[model samples]
Target chain A: MSEEKRTDLESLGEFGTIDLLTKNFLITRESTAFGIGDDAAVLERNEEQYTLVSTDMLVEGVHFNLMYVPFKHLGYKSVAVNVSDIAAMNGTPEQITVSIAVSNRFPLEALEELYDGIRLACQHYKVDLVGGDTTSSRSGLVISVTAIGVVDKSKVVYRSGAGTNDLLVVSGDLGAAYVGLQVLEREKSVFQANPDIQPDLDGKDYIIQRQLKPEARMDVIAYLKELEVVPTSMIDVSDGLASEILHLCKSSKKGAMVYNAKLPIDSLTSTTALDFNLDPVTCVLNGGEDYELLFTVSQNDFDKIKGNPHMTIIGYMTDASDGIYLVDKNESLIPLSAQGWDHFQQ
Target chain B: MSEEKRTDLESLGEFGTIDLLTKNFLITRESTAFGIGDDAAVLERNEEQYTLVSTDMLVEGVHFNLMYVPFKHLGYKSVAVNVSDIAAMNGTPEQITVSIAVSNRFPLEALEELYDGIRLACQHYKVDLVGGDTTSSRSGLVISVTAIGVVDKSKVVYRSGAGTNDLLVVSGDLGAAYVGLQVLEREKSVFQANPDIQPDLDGKDYIIQRQLKPEARMDVIAYLKELEVVPTSMIDVSDGLASEILHLCKSSKKGAMVYNAKLPIDSLTSTTALDFNLDPVTCVLNGGEDYELLFTVSQNDFDKIKGNPHMTIIGYMTDASDGIYLVDKNESLIPLSAQGWDHFQQ
Candidate 1:
């Protein structure tokens, strides 16, 4: 008798698994300008424009908990995350197709609430909800969204386009969304212990909102354009900051140096991390789901964006030989590591 | 407290549920040529072409039983179904994005096998796999696919274009895939009852293949183009012939008369359906998942496709006042009802 071999999915991680599976898929269409290995796939649209396609799936329990997360927020977050992917490519989102599968446990009203949130997001982003699929699942709810966007041929950015000495910039403060999730989880635990007790989420509105209704940084994209400073490379911070930096460095075959003092962390997030007995800097570096734009611009273009309040310069790219590192508070060059969320590992 | 209102999803059904949820979403993008209520959404691409986007979600147990379905076939069918939507719009599929959520129960080898089938389908359809999302689920496997296609501006077809005197047509045979599923289900029950049973799937290859690996009718689109015949209205037969016929009637504001004797049922399907003591006509009318093309053409163009081996002319369009009906073998008119598979109702 012959024995069969089996490999665990946890060992490969998400990116590794996708690489192993899609590595052999040959690109046979002239319309496919780019395939995989990016925030969104690029396709040739016309002489002056390129189309961007991005998709994401959010499974209940795996991505969110219905106990504390409302149906409307889930729907809105799903669209926001996918739109962020388009923004990561330096494109303007124009349309979205959302497909959802839910069990009978959710009534028609529940789904209606979900659609309301989706409609709100569409209106806020000015993207049309063009199409979708609705069907039944055996258990839990799964929402998948695909966003279509467009960019000028000359303005589109990619992770592989970062240049040596480019300044790394990020929009909005970091670690708030991660801290928001922690508060939600804690409140959930307290409620599970006693159903009669109300969740005490006072004075944490900013962080909570960051987690519940994080907006895609379309405004930052507009600001960069107004400043006449196009990013050489860009990515969305769905994963932790450290993990995204590693991705940029690997894709462009460059190294990076970030200063711990320059890391952006909200005061509420810092205080909350301390209350939870965790380091705020670690949360900013490793906590995810921020949806903020992490990008790099040429050193020469720094003058245009240096005083911009919406964005901050966190680091600079270096030669590959320098290796990726963070200058800690004590002036020590600590090698950066990625501890981003991996659902399979969890 | 006021009594909370709750509506069951089963009562609304799939189409009704989609309409209710999306009725309030207004299209805001100039690029959005058409949105929702069709096999695929259309967007303005350029001077010569219009882009098409179609999406579908398949869930385990509700959509397919893993006990009987191979992983590779499921992967292939997922892509095929989305491509079928593009074909229904008379478009050429150019790229596809496939997102899958699976639990830890599935090993890396299982996913690799699934991707192997996806790659094969991409090759066969001549479409590029541009991008997708991969995530972990709490239970079961869910696959969502989005296909992008393009059609010449002059050749684009829509469901609302049928004329009162148009001829109704269908590609390939019907009822085979439904009967094939029945055979597999029976075999599965027998296997569950007794492990040592050498199942009898003999002489059932045609029907079984139809159910397991149904191909999108892209060939029909090619043939129509070659014959210089453009369908006035079209839809993919994913939800049974009767249901699709009703969709054409409702969308085009016309009535249809289908002749039962003209339904293209393969000999194998007829015999197998009879063996199960089921009416073959009923299966043809209500059993879904055929992945065939159902279309209407102007009577003036009938000569172009009158004797095509791959297509069958089953009926003709009538005035909306005449109502939709089917002429049975007895030459008696009977109102057509949609008993097509509805997962929510099931």
Candidate 2:
């Protein structure tokens, strides 16, 4: 490192860093149908089925602050996020491996509480807790969860499958998790200033729940199966709408045209964003950790999804020659920029 | 945690912690051929094969030290150790997901060096690097690797398959990795006190390599296939020979009797143990991180493995009432104790 050119991780960004490090890791196994560039890696289990695999790691202080985050909530969020990754692939998760590295400072009871949340998530998802590794860390806590799922080979979707003219749809409202985080941060600062002052998060239950216990949209996946509609391409909104949409565009070699006013935002999210003196539109575009499913379907299937409470068509795919852009409220076109959560920033 | 029963993690130990936490995780999936209590979790992929899954977490300070250990070796060892788990199950690893949580203090160049080793190991094993998550940490680096493998249902081995009178066999020699660690630790201290002084590790290359980069016993697995010998029960020798033998005994509900005379000990390992004023027998019994395969084979398959350069028959399984014991050089019986690596100690 001393003699080589040193590059700061923050400047490279999280996805950029992953791309740089794994560029040479060519997939040689025939079973590996897809690797690296999607919500989940797909492997052909047999001629008829494909196994979907995805892993996510949550680090204390970087992902969540224990001072405001309960261990139970943290555990549930960790599993839910990984489950969302599987859901992004339009697959049903059947098993997961949860590995945790905790500091000695954490008592056994603390871990039990965390496991309680994990157990609840596993039960809710109906996925077996198959295997895991537990070891002590020198500092803080680290939880890494890998989810395994299956999908029919004919029904499998990929990020590179979207075509021009496909209608873009989202499963849930955006920006609530980011706004909930703002509320928590503000309340923490207020408590620090005056320990006796109680938190005033009385009627903000929706946003709080959205942030603390976000659910993977397995219900939407089930609904899609019931409707007999398969998305050409899909991704989860873990890194906000803007970033995820751009990823889909990059992988599919297409462009997207998103109508800013058509974005689904919770009323509370908009109100909270205004209260924090931030633009609500910006929050909806860039707010992360929503865990919502974003997908593109053929125009022929648009009527089937029309008027569905769970579905919202916000945009349409465009030819690669057209740049990814957003039509703002003022009817002005602006190019989209990805401002996803970058954990490497100091 | 304060008012309730605050049990310490050390009292629970690593294995105990995993058992207690996952005890309520009911495996409702029909695909789960086996869950927990083995080198890897097994899933029935089809009538012909079972999918083997295992995960391991490596944390800096607890599992390794960057002061002396190179990141490249650490990367290779991490993947190699996880692959050993699959090998212990008599499976061929096909894919792996590696998640690393690193602090922002790390340079992009350092991560590149680590990935270089990871890429090398993947190439050597011919396994696809499917997918993983990378995130920033507040402290030292944490790596979690999950390996997926496949074994024919007829050839699959588990830690619970051994029966009374089965012979215990181990691949390769023991105590070398522990002695090598001692050498590196001594060199580190010497370098700390006098940075200008060169390290005196010229002839200790064999043992040092064993400590820094232990290979998984996949070769032994291939050899066993060639000999058409399926072990009754098997496990990887990561937590010392004594501990691994006890694990197989417990899982199989049998007792084992190992003779000190039959244990394979390298000449360099014995010479280094004496240099450190440690008992060579004790080191062979209690030193961990060998990454060798320990298995129990039926008496009928003895001829297939006998005289094999990679394997040594060290012991035999016995009735549960016989109790696990070690036969000393003096011909005295002593109870076996498992002093495996427990990372929860303060």
lDDT of 1 by residue, B1-346 (tens): 1129788899999988999999999999999999998999999899999999999999999999998888899889999999999999999999999999999878888998889889889999999999998899999999999999999999999999999989999999999999999999999999999979977899999999999999999999999999999999999999889999999999999999999999999999999999999899999999999999999999999898888889999999999999999999999999988989899998
Q: After superposition, how far is residue B103 of candidate 1 from its true place, in Å?
A: 0.3
lDDT of 2 by residue, B1-346 (tens): 3456788898889989999998988999988889877889998786698888999999999889998788899989989999999999999999999999998888998899888889999988888898898899999999999999999999999999999999999999998999899999999999999999888998899889999999998999999999989999999999889999999999999999999999999999999999999898888788989899999999999889889999999989999899999998898999999886777753
Which tens-of-lDDT digit does each residue in A1-346 have in candidate 2? Answer: 4655878898988998999999999989987899888999998787788889999999999999998888898889889999999999999999999999998788998999899899899989989899999999889999999999998999988888999999999998999998998999999999999999999898888998999999999999999999999999999999889999999999999999999999999899899899999898888788889999999999999878998999899999999899999999898999999887888863
Over A80-173, each residue of candidate 1 has an lDDT whose tens digit, in order, gives: 9999999999999999999999998888888988998999999999999999999999999999999999999999999998899999999999
Cα deviation at A8, candidate 2, in Å, is 1.2
How many clashes would you count in candidate 1? Answer: 0
Which lDDT value does model 2 have at A154?
Answer: 90
lDDT: worst 10-residue window of model 1 chain B: B1-10
